[model samples]
Target: MKAFTDLEVWQRSRVLRNDISQLTKSFPSEEKYRLSDQIIRSSRSVGNNIAEGHGRFHYIDSSRFLITARGSLIETLDHLIVALDEKYITEEIFNKFKGDYETCLRMLNGYITYLRNQQPQKNG
Candidate 1:
């Protein structure tokens, strides 16, 4: 890709990050530095890591950052489940965000696979 922002996964993650920011605003004040902060940070990390990965010169280095990005995505999902259990969001809202998570995940995995293919073949 021309830039990290150009990656489909990064673009999709930006949408989710924005949505999570807005969603957390409705959370209880008590959660301002708790679950809300965690979810927001994790969501933001997804894009941050993806951008860092895209800037790497080596495919292996990029893959490592992408893996961390994927982990942050999963962490965001856990925060969503916590929100649901605490009645901070409706089941409908949870499902919507979950779908968005899956889309980013699929795209990220595909990108990782593409990068793997681009690696030089080993003589082993």
Candidate 2:
């Protein structure tokens, strides 16, 4: 992959973010300031954090950001659960989104492990 955009986790997170954005529009107006806002923020944070981590000069820093991204993914899942409980979304849709987010989480975890296992460059 030539860029952060090429990373599978990043790409999937972007798609998930877009999916959540569109789904939120169907929520009641009252949710605009609550659950909808939360899911949107958390979903977008996943990709944003991943990209930020990719840009970091040190592998440790990248891993840190990846961890944060993973946290955001969890947060997004929490918001989804709330939506499901509130009857804002159907069981089928919730399951699908949750499954996709879980996949992204697994991929992000693998990426983090890879980064942590890498040896730092030695000074010349």
Candidate 3:
């Protein structure tokens, strides 16, 4: 109905970026330029892409950007899983951030579905 910034997905993504920044601080120094950096970059991409898409003039373009944002979110989650497996994070921390990631994913998917259903048909 409104712009992507006004969407719950964007808001949640902003919060997610902040949370990922904080969480990455607890990672081992060896990962400072590796997983930690990647996690932060990927997390930020989610919000950035949404904002960029919101500024686009077409719904299809916006939807495409949101899809890219969702892909980045998935990438970040994969890095989180690796951090957990490598002992960079404890189960408690993993559970907390993992929950947020899952919520973001669900919201992104819902928005994508909504966008697709709203598109008008072409006469071909």
Candidate 4:
């Protein structure tokens, strides 16, 4: 990969971030600084971490950031759950976003595994 944007996981995350941002815009102003902000931040974090990870160059270093990105993906999903509970979104919307989250999760996991396999074996 020449750039972080080239990663499929990063691309999926970007889509999720945009979707979350658009969804939050319909939320009541009362949640402007609360759940709305939380979801947006978490969604954005996924892509941010992926990019940062790719920039690290080393397998272990990149893996650390990828792990963080995975956490952010889970966090974003939790936020979506909260949105569903609060009726800010319908079941259909929630499911769609959930699918998007899962795709990113899978892609991220696959990338991490690929990185690990590509790492050089160390001899004592």
Candidate 1 error regions (>4 Å): none
- lDDT at 20, model 4: 91
Best by TM-score: 1
**Model 2: how far residue 57 lies from native, Å:** 0.5
TM-score of 4: 0.96
lDDT of 4 by residue, 1-124 (tens): 5888887789889999998999999999999999999999999999999999999968999999999999999999999999999999999999999999888899999999998998899899
Our model 3 lands, by Cα RMSD against the true structure, at 1.6
TM-score of each: 0.98, 0.94, 0.92, 0.96
Q: Over the full model, what C-alpha lDDT does candidate 2 score relative to the true structure?
A: 0.95
Which candidate comes out best when scored by lDDT?
1
Q: Residue 14, candidate 4: how far off, in angstroms?
A: 0.6
Which tens-of-lDDT digit does each residue in 1-124 have in candidate 2?
Answer: 3599999999999999999999999999999999999999999999999999999988899999999999999999999999999999999999999899889999999999999889566788
Worst 10 residues of 4 by lDDT: 1-10
How many backbone clashes can be found in candidate 4?
0
Per-residue lDDT over 1-124 for candidate 1, one digit per residue giving the tens place of the 0 to 100 score: 4988888899999999999999999999999999999999999999999999999999999999999999999999999999999999999999999999999999889988999999999896
**Model 1 / residue 80 / CA error / Å:** 0.1
Error of 1 at 18 (Å): 0.2
Model 3, residue 74: distance off in Å is 0.5
Residues 5-67, model 3: lDDT tens digits: 788999999999999999889888999999999999999999999888878888799899999
